[model samples]
Target: MAGHSKWANIKRQKAVVDAKRGKTFTQLSRAIILAARNGVPDPSGNFQLRTAIEKAKAAGIPNDNIERAIAKGAGTFSGDNHSLEEIRYEGYGPCGVAILIEALTDNRNRTAADLRVAFSKNGGNLGETGCVSWMFDQKGVCIVQGVVDEDQLLEASLEGGAESYEMTEEETAEVVTEVANLEILNQTLKDKGFQVTDAELRWIPSNNVEVTDSDQARSLLKLIDTLESLDDVQNVTSNFDMSEQLLSVSVV
Candidate 1:
């Protein structure tokens, strides 16, 4: 999962920018609403809703906004009839890298057009559904930062039924667990005095496509950034790897 760590690092950086632009709250709100709409509004009774709320709280989202989103999604608010649809798109980016996009949009056509344009402008093309999705596996990922002890985190993760874990050079511990155990593992880590930076269900690639060329790597990153900037897009996952040098130089 070499590419996974690199992508995670880049995402961490982009998240800061997103938060600065006030887009983080909007995205978190959508996630909460979708989670609530699919399951119980009470986080304690809904695993997905609980995870969404935890992530929103970690991101410093206001409690009132979160509550309002949950109420709106649960159909408790009058005149709140907005219907949201979840869609997945598969594609190939530069260097034959397989890409998966998860979007929540009310208008599928507009989102599709925006994604297609972004792909075309960045030397990529959207593919048929399931084209690249089969190359990924869904798993729960929890990232903890801020001076965490790797050994302690590993021990806690093991006790919490985590599948595996690794400490990145940036002093972040990424723990992988089954989708059903995400909340447990996250709570376990938090109880162990680890500050969880991010935790959610994610699609992890089975293998990585190595992009040795700097230009190709740059284009791939740009394509992903553009796609993620779209309001409808929620998450973008790809199977691409590059040297740390290239990653540093390619940051836009």
Candidate 2:
């Protein structure tokens, strides 16, 4: 398995635990608000909002919280006058690993300062825009886990408009599709009785940088974790790869 996939699995497991602590809910609410802000509040009419709501529901978020977030984004609620904007930060971590961070923030200066500190303190340096973004392509990725035949899932995903599908070493199916068809493909797979685990659009690196030294791997993971812990940070992607053995020993 690729290192990023391994890290993704770890993050997914951590998300479940975080959900109980309300951290995941906070992030999900931000995502919901951002999606609603960019499109209609009704999920049926806005694909991004629909995807965000689905993700929140999967994480066990309450319907009331989701509704309130939508209302706040749609201007139905006057609780706050803050406006959010999306920002992408590019940088290089330990061992020259390319990192891309996506954030939604009401204050850009604070976000930038937080990120700069995170990178500088963790053996990384923030770079100019497009520094590492060109190495990544925006695509839709859907992960499904359950007892199912790989061939059957692959066939269904392809038929549902997936560009590619593969089974990860951990037995999860990863389906890739064009960003525009993510929702349609997700529904098709779900309708076919597949238990979808995660579906979203993300920046996927074209190639991965292998991390052989344990210390470098540890530093890289720490950097990514710090960035994710930020209140405004939504997603972080890196091009680091490590052996399963090293990852098990180095990552906590």
Candidate 3:
């Protein structure tokens, strides 16, 4: 869990950089669309939609764009008829580190081809579905920032049905719960005056492969970056662990 906690912290920093470059807008909009399409368009009535909208707002997305995405998802906007479907892809990276990807795509063949190329070009290979998925479990994660009392957070989490909570960084804490209890735990934290910033479902690897070789570390990171660069990829998860020092040098 600590390895994943470290990875999550790095991702948070990367997201800030990505947002400044306007690279997160497309992904954020797609999330809003999918949330709205799966449930009600109104954020107040739909937890997923509300979470997506909050993420978009945090990324500095314009209200108009957010509304347009919702309209498209609800099939109320004129001439926008594209339907997106969520799919999961599995593969192996350097050192047999299992990798799992979640994507939202309108064309499966195109997305598959794009992923195949991304993997093959970066020292990995796209494998059949379920090949690596079995190594992980899906859990809901809620991130809270600012200094917080560990005891208080633990109590609140327990009351909200959270399974575990940990401080992933000096000022950031992550609370994990069952998929169905995510909404409850998020609201509970907010009610307790915690500054909850993000909430989403994440694949948690049951086991991890440690990468000490610098070359293998570089290849793994490159494979992950390449996979994430694809427009259709929503999330990429892998079961690799490396030291922060190695990670810093391996980001080629």
Candidate 4:
């Protein structure tokens, strides 16, 4: 796989671009609403809802808006004919990096049309199912940061039955696991007094594609930037790690 640092950099850039396009808020709300719909509206009983709510709060979404969204999702209150569905898309970016796009979309028709445009404009081809998914594996990822040392955090994660722990720094770590071990692992880390920044199921690459030349990297990022700019696209995952030099290229 492309190194974690490279992927982290790509994630960072995607966040910035998503925010600028005013797409992040919509995507976050969809996630919040979806989380509420599937699980109980209360975050206490619903871990996904809790994660979505926290993300909304971080984005500065107001309390009332959040509550209303939850209500709508739970079918207690509503305005639009909103039903959430999960969509997975496969595509290839520059340098042939396998890309997977996941979204919680209300309007599949609109989302697909927009995504197709994005793919074509960005030099990517949105493929049929199973084109790129095999390159990845579904796993739970818990990122621990802000206040826990690696040793302490590792101790907590290991004790919690976490499959593995990745030390990003002295104070930050990543706990990875199989689907079954997710909750127990996250709870273990949290129970051990570690600040769990994020705990969610994600698709991790079995192996990563590499982009060495600056031009190739820039081209690849262009595809990512465009895909993420769509209002319906939530999380865009790729096999290439982002480079600082590649990030310097302005996406227009």
lDDT (Cα, tens digit) per residue for candidate 1, span 1-252: 376477767687767666444666777889999999999899999878887898788788889989998998898877876788899999999988999999988899999999999999999999999999999999998888864466787788898899998777567777899998998998898898888877888998888899889888889889988888888888899888777778878875
Candidate 1 C-alpha RMSD relative to the actual structure: 2.0
Cα lDDT tens digits, model 2, 1-252, are 778878888888887767345667878999999999899999999988987998899888899999989998898877678888899999999999999999989999999999999999999999999999999999899888883588878777987899987677556878999998998898899998998877889888899999999888888899998998898899999888889898888776
Give the whole-model CA lDDT for all candidates, comma-separated: 0.85, 0.88, 0.87, 0.76
Q: Candidate 1's C-alpha lDDT? A: 0.85
- Across 1-252, the per-residue lDDT of candidate 4 in tens digits comes to 244345564465466545463566687787888889888999999888998898888777788888888987898885667677889999887778888999777788898888888878766788889999999998888888764456776677778877787765556667898876887888887788888877877888888776777776766777776787777788888887654455556333
Worst 10 residues of 3 by lDDT: 1-10
- Relative to the unseen true structure, what is the C-alpha lDDT of residue 200 in candidate 2, on a scale of 0 to 100? 88
Off by over 4 Å in 4: 1-5, 9-21, 242-252
Question: Which of the predicted structures, 1 or 3, would earn the higher TM-score when compared with the native?
Answer: 3
Candidate 1 Cα outliers beyond 4 Å, as residue runs: 19-22, 58-60, 146-148
After superposition, the stretches of candidate 2 with alpha carbons farther than 4 Å from their true spots are none
- Count of steric clashes across candidates, in order: 0, 0, 0, 2
RMSD (CA, Å), candidate 3 to true, equals 1.5
Q: Name every residue pair that clashes in candidate 2.
A: none
Cα RMSD (angstroms) for every candidate in the order listed: 2.0, 1.5, 1.5, 2.8
Per-model TM against the reference: 0.92, 0.95, 0.95, 0.87
Backbone clashes (count) for model 3: 0
